[model samples]
Target: MPALLIDRPTCPATQLHSARRLIAEERLHTLFQPIVSLDCGVIYGHEALVRGPAGSPLEMPDALFAAGRAEGLSMELEIRCALQAMKDWSQLQRPGKLLINMSAAALSQATADGRWQRGLGICEDYGLQPTELMIELTEHERVADIDALRRGLTLLRRLGVGVALDDFGDGRSSLRLWSEIQPNLVKIDKYFTRELPAHAEKLQTFRALLQLAETFGAQLVAEGIEQPEELRVLRDLGVSYGQGWLLGHPSSSGASEAAPAALQVLASKEIAVMPELRRAGGSGITAEKLMMPAPAISDQASHEQLYRFFTEHEDQHAVAVINAAQQPVALIDRAQFISRWAKPFFMDLYGRRPCTLYANPSPLIVDADTGIEALTRVLTSADQRYLREGFIISRQGRYLGLGTGEQLVRSVTEARIEAARHANPLTFLPGNIPLSQHIGRLLSSGREFVAAYADLNQFKPFNDQYGYWRGDEMIRLVARVIGAHCDSQRDFVGHVGGDDFVMLFQSDDWEQRCEQIVGRFNELARNLFDAEALEAGGIMAEDREGNLRFHPCTTLSIGAVRVAPGRLHRAEDVASAAAAAKRQAKHGALAVYVMAA
Candidate 1:
C-alpha cells in the first residue's frame, strides 16, 4: 500500500496562492449533488463538490485532492475549494443544509488560536448561516489532539452548525471517531455501497453501521450510489439519505431542481423495485398503454344541462358529471343518455326512473394514486359488480373521473393475449419468458427497484399430503394474496408456476405491501391446510431425490433484492441473486430476506 501523506503550509502563504490563482484564472469550480430524504422523497440539502477548472489536468476530485497535498497546501486548498463551492452554488440557498468538505487538519489549525472567528466572518460575508452550513470532515485524516478537535466541534455545535463524518467506514478509526466526534451525520463511503447487491456480509455490515449511526443520533447518508439496483437495496436496508450519479449528477451551477433530461434519466433507470408496467421494451400491452386520461367537463348545469352537453359532445362515449368545484358526481354514458332521450314518453309516465342510470358511488371509483394493477383488481371483482356503461371515480365524495368496463376489458384482453404466449398452463400466468423480458427491461432502465421471489415454505410436503387439488387451491390462494398486495398497474405479481411467484415493487410503499402480503397469506394459508396436518407442524412430501419424507412447515420466504442504480446490467442476474437471497432467508429462519446492502 502507498503511504498516505498530508502536507501543511502557513495559512497566509496558501491564501496568497489561492487569491493569485483566482485573479489570473478560474482555478476553482463547484458541483452540487442532492442529499435527499428517504421518507418524503424531498431534497433536504446538497453536498457541495469542488473541482479544478476544465483546462487543468487536476479536473477530477481525486487528482485535485492529491495535487493539493503534493503542493504542501492541503488545508488551504480545501478551505478555498469549499468557499468557492459555496459562492458558485449560492442559488441552492433553500431551507436546507449546505455540506462543505473540510479537512481535519484545517479545523485543528483554526481551533489552535481563534481561527474559527475569522472563518465564521468569511461565512457571514458569503451570506450563509451557521445553522445552514455543515462541515464534512474527511474520516481518514487523523485528529491529533482529541481535546482540540472536540472543542472546535463543540463550539461549532454551540453556534447551531452541524458536523458530518465524511467517507465514513473507509478507515480504521470510524467506530472510534463515532464515539468521540458524535457528528450530526455519518456518510457511508461508496466502497461499501458498491458491494451491496452481491455481498451478503457487507450488506449486514452496512445495515449495522446505519443502525449504529441512528443510535448515535446521526442521520445515515450512503454515498456513491450510482446504480438503480443499488438505490433500491439501500432504501430497503433503511438508509435515510443518499447521493449518487444515478439519482442526479453533480452540477456547479448550484441548481436545486432536476431538469427534464435528469428527470427522464431518473425515471428510465428501472430497478426491480419499480412497478413492472413502468418498464420499457417488452412489447407487451398493459393497462397503462391502453388507458386514456379522464375527460374533463367544465360547465356544471342541472340534469337538463348535462343532458344537452352530452348531446353536444356526442363523440364522447362516457362523461363524468362533475359539480362546479370539479368533483365528479355521477357518470353519464352516451348510450344511456341518448337512449333516455329517445324514450321521453317512458320518462313521462315513470317520472325519470328509467332514464336515471346512475352508478353507485361506492363501487365505481379510482384514486389518482391507484395503479393499473389495483384498478384491474377493482374491475375484476365479482362483488364490486361494474356496470356495462362505466364506473365513476371520486374522492372525498367528489367525482373525479370515469372508467369504462369496455376500456378495462380491452386492456385486460390485450394483456391476457400477450400473457398467453408465454404463460404457464398450470397457473395460467405469464411464464419465465415474459418474466425475463420484464426483468431485463427493469435492469436496462437503470431505476431503483426491488425484485421479490416469493416461494411457499415447505410447500412440497403440503402438496404430497393434500394432493394436487388442495395444492392448486394453495397456489390460487397465493396468487390472490400476491394480487391483493399489488397497488400500481405498473406493479407486477406473476405466478412463476407452482408455489413460486414474482413481484416487482416500485415507489415507496413496497415494504408496506410486502407486510400486507405476508399477513394476508399467513391468515389465508392457515385455513387451507388440514387442521390435523397444520397442528402437527409437518407435512409429508417427496424431495428432489424422490423419497417421501415429512418436512417441517414454514411460512413464505420472499427474497427481496434492492437494485442499486448502475449496479446491475441484466435482469437474469437479479433473479438469480434474489433466489440466492431467498435461500439465505430460509436458512436464517426469516420469512423475508432482503439481499444485504
Candidate 2:
C-alpha cells in the first residue's frame, strides 16, 4: 500500500523497467528478522525476508512484492529471493530455527521438475534439516485449490518442515479451515495486536483467538505487539509464541546482540526474593517482626486494642483468636467483637462461665507455602470472602499470626508502580530520566551511539479535526509504530511529547526503521478514517479564510545524526541537530533527512 523508491531512475517508466532488470539480473538480496522465545526471552530463530538491490527502485520489500505481482513475475522474484535468503541465512546457522516465506500460489503452481523442487533439494544438499525450516503461508493470497495446497503442505510436513499460517485473522478463513488444515503455528495479524491494550474489543478477540489456537492444538503467537502494555497483556494471556517489530525487526543476518532498552525488563530484588522464599517454604516474617498480638475479647479489655490493630495494620481486616497454646483457632472482626462479644449476654451469662458466640462460626486456614498468585485468587473467591476477614497462617504445623488480603495487595501494587515508571507514557519509550542515565553509563564506559529525532507532519491539523480523544489514540498508534521498528535492538526511544520522538541506536539501520514506521503509520491511519473522508482526497474543514478547505492528512519526518565520542558531547545537542534536519524533511513526503554535522 505504501510506495518507496529505493533507487528509481528519474522517469517512472524507466523506474519500472529498472525493477524488471534488477530481478532478471538476480541482484536481489535477503534479510533475517529474529523471532525470540517469549518464555525465556531468548532468540529462538529468525524469519528470512526479501530485499532488492542496494540501489534498486524497490526499496521496501512489500513495495517490491507489489511491483513483482503487477508485472506477473511474483513467483520468479519470490523463488530468487527465497534462495538468496537461505544462502545468506546458511552462513550464520546457529542452534536456531529458520522461517521462510512461501506463497500458496507458488507452492501449488505445478513445479515438480521445476525451480521449487530444485530449491528444496538444494537445501537438503546443504545439510539443512527439513525440521529446521518453517514455511510461512501468506494469508492475503487466495488458495485457488485447497486440496492442492493441502497436498503440498502435507508433503512438506512429512518432510519434517513446519507450516505456519501467517496473518491468520486478517483474512476471511473460517474455523472449518482451522479444523481441517490445522497449522503448526498461527501468527496473529498486527492489525489486532497494535491497539489491543487500549481497545477492549481487540483484547477480547485476541483472547478468544488464543483459546481457539489452543483448542486446535496450535501454538498462538500475538504478533505486532509494539507496546509494553500489549506485550504484558499477551504474556498474561498465555500466548506462547510471538513475532513483531516490537520483538525484533527483520535483519540482514538475523543475529541480534542485545534487547532494546525499552524492552529490557528490570527484575526487582523482591522478585529475586520470591525463589528464596519458596526454597525456605515462605516469608515467615512480616514488617513488624513481633508475633501478632491477639485481639482481647475480655469484658475488661477495651475495644481500643481492636481499633488500633485495624487502623495500624491496614492489611489485617480480620483479627484472630489466639489459644493458650499460642495457635490461632478462630478469626474475629471488630463488628463481631462490638455487637456479639461486648453485648450484655456475655456479662449476663457469667463473667465466670463460657460464652458460645464469642468465636466465629467458619474460619479459613492457609499454609506458609501458599504463593501470592494462588492466595490472591483464594481470598477473592466468594466462598473465601469471609476469609479475607482474617486467615490462619501456619508453617510446618506451627500456627503463625493471622494475615489479611489487604496487606498482600498493597505490597504487590507498590511493586508494580515502581516497575512501570521506567518508560515515558506518551511515546512509551525510555524517558529523558532513564535515557540520560543510560547514555551517561554507556559514555562513561566508552560506547559509541547515534541519535535520531522524529516528528509528525501536519499532525496538528489532523488532531484539530479528529478531536483530542482520537488524537491521543493516533499519537499512541504512531508511538507503537516507531517502537515496533526499533524492535529488540540496543536502541533508546523517548517522547518529547506531542508528535515528536527520539531514538538512540548503534547501527545505521535507523533509516530503515524510520521508513517502515512512516509507511505503516500512514497505511493504518488511512484505514482508521471514515470512507467518505478517505474518498474526499483530504478531509474538508474551515480554513483560515473561513471557507471550507481540505487539509492534507498527517505524515512523519525523521532526522538522524551520528553520535561519535568527540563530535557530540551531550544527548541534547545531538537531538537539537536532528530536530532541525527533521524540519527540512517535513517539507517532503515522509522522508528521513540526515544531519550533515
Candidate 3:
C-alpha cells in the first residue's frame, strides 16, 4: 500500500501566526482531567489542560506553550488560559477544586503586570472563591527571585488560593523550592510512576517522597498513572491522590464526568483480599463484592449492533453505552431497545444510526466502594426509568461496569436477612455474634480502641414492677441515647441481649463521648417512671428473698477497657477486662469505670 497522506503547516511563520491569533482572539480552550482519591474511589479535583483549536498547529499543550514562549507572549498566554479555565469551570459546576497550571516565570510576570488581580476578578464573577481554586506551579523555569515568589504566594494564600508544587522530584531544585514555598499539595512526576511495580528502587524513592509530604502536611498526588500495577503499588504505598490516563483523560468541553476505572479495580481487589486477611470475624461487605462485570456497548455502536448484542445475550437486562475513553455516557434497557426494534420498519429506519441517539442519556452512577445499605437506598429512591435501565458502577467517575436492579435488590435483601439473624430482638441492634466479630476484626487489624460494656443497675426489680413490655421500651430508649452520643463513623454499638450492651469506640474523643452517653441516659431514665415514682426516685418491689424494698430507677453502669495494640491478642481478653470494670461501675448509679492499667 502507498504511504498515507497527512496535512501539515508548510511554514514556521504560519504556525507562529496561528499561535498569535489564538492569543489575540482568546480562542484557547481548557480541558480538565480528574485527580482521584484511590482509597475513597472519588474525584478529589481536576487539572485544567489548555488546548488550541482542533487541527491547529498549537493544538498540543507543549507546542502551544512553547510557541508562546518563543514569541515572548508566555505570560499573556498563561493569564488568558487561567481566565478561560476559571470561567468554564464555574459554568461546569463540578464539585471539586479546579487546578490551573502556571509556570514560576508566569507567576512573577502576572504579579508584575497586575494581571493576577484580573484573574481573581474572573473568579469572583463566576461565584468562585479563592479556596475553590488551586494554582499549580509547573516549575519548568528556575526561580529568578525567591523573595518575590514567596511574597506573591503569600498574598495568594491570604486570599485563600492554595499553591501546589508540580513535577516534583524532576530537578535538583525541586526540594529547595518545596521548602521555600511550603505548598499545600505536591504532584510527583510521571517518571517514578512508570513501571513502578517492577522497580523496587523507584518504590523506595516514592516511599521517601510520601514521608516527605507527611512531614510538611502536604498531600502527594502521583501523576501519569496508566497501568493497573502502577495503581496497585501507589495504593499499597498509601499515596493519597492520583491522576493519569488510567484514571481519565482530558476533554475539551470540560472534565470527563465519568468515574475512574482504577478506583473500581482497587475497590474490587480490597473486597476480595482484605476481608480474607482479617476474617477472624464476619467481614464487612461492600458493593464491589456483589458487582458483576458490567455489560457494556460502545457509544459509537450502530443501532443494528445493539440489536444483535441484545439478541445474542438474552440474559442481559441492560447495557452501559460508553464513549471512546471508556466512560459511560448512557444506559440502554434491553427490553426497551428490543421493543422499539420489534416495531415494523424500525431496523430499516434507524439500524445504521448510532445507538447513543436512542439510549437513555442519564443513568445512575455509583462508586464501587458504596456500602450495600447505601446502594439499596439510592436505588429505591431513584426514578423508575433508572431502576428499569439498571445503573453504572464507577471507581472515581470512570465506568467500571453495569449492575442490574435485580442483583442490587437481591444482595441487599440477603445482607439484611443475615444481619437480622444476629440482631438483638429488643433494640434491634447487632447482637453478641456481631459484637464479638467486630471486636475480633478490630484486634486483628491492630487498632487501638476502647471497648465499653454497659449494664443496667437495679433492672431486675424495675422489670418485675414495670412489666417486660415497658422494660423493653426502656432498653430501646437507652440504645437510641447511646447511638446519638457515639461517633457513627468510628464507633460500633451492639446489644448483647437483655439489659447488657457493648460499645467499641475508635475515636480519640471516646472518653467525652462515653461521659455524654452516661449523662444523657441518667436524664432520660427518670421519664420512664410514673409521677409518684419520679418524685420518690424509686419504685417499691419485692426482692429475690421476698422482702419488700424501695428500688432505685434503672441506671446505666459502663465498664470501659482501653485495648492497646499488642497488649491484647483476642476479643475475649478485652471483654474480660471490660466485665471486671462493669462490676466496679454497678456499685453506683449511672457510673463509668475505666479499667486500671
Write down the TM-score for model 2. Answer: 0.42
Tens-digit lDDT track of model 3 for 238-339: 898889988888875544443446866567422111111111112366666656785688988999999889888888788888888878899998888888
- Position 355, candidate 3: lDDT: 96
Q: Relative to the true structure, how large is the alpha-carbon lDDT of every model?
A: 0.66, 0.62, 0.77
The lDDT of model 2 is 0.62
Tens digits of per-residue lDDT, candidate 2, 1-597, equal 011223333443335434455654555677777676665567767778787765556867877888888877787666667666666676776657787887777766523324555666677666666688787777534767788788887877777878777777886655666677788877788888885655657766877887888788898766776665566556545677667777777777575532573145311100100000011112333322323544433322234544455557665456665556655565666555445446666544544443224556456666666654455465456775453365667665446665655665564455334333445444455545555654554454344565677887666666778888878888888788876887442466666667778776754576788778778888877765667778875677766676777776766778777656566666566667777777777766546877654
TM-score of 1: 0.44
Provide the RMSD of all predictions against the true structure, rounded to 1 decimal: 19.6, 20.6, 21.5
Clashes of each: 38, 5, 9
Cα distance off (Å), candidate 1, residue 181? 0.6
lDDT of 2 at 531: 76
Score residue 168 of candidate 1 by CA lDDT. Answer: 83
Q: For residues 513-587, could you state the per-residue lDDT of candidate 1 as single tens digits?
A: 777787788777878777776897766778879888877754676778887777777767877877887788777
Model 1 lDDT vs. the true structure? Answer: 0.66
Error of 3 at 30 (Å): 0.6
Give the TM-scores of the predictions, in the order they appear. 0.44, 0.42, 0.44
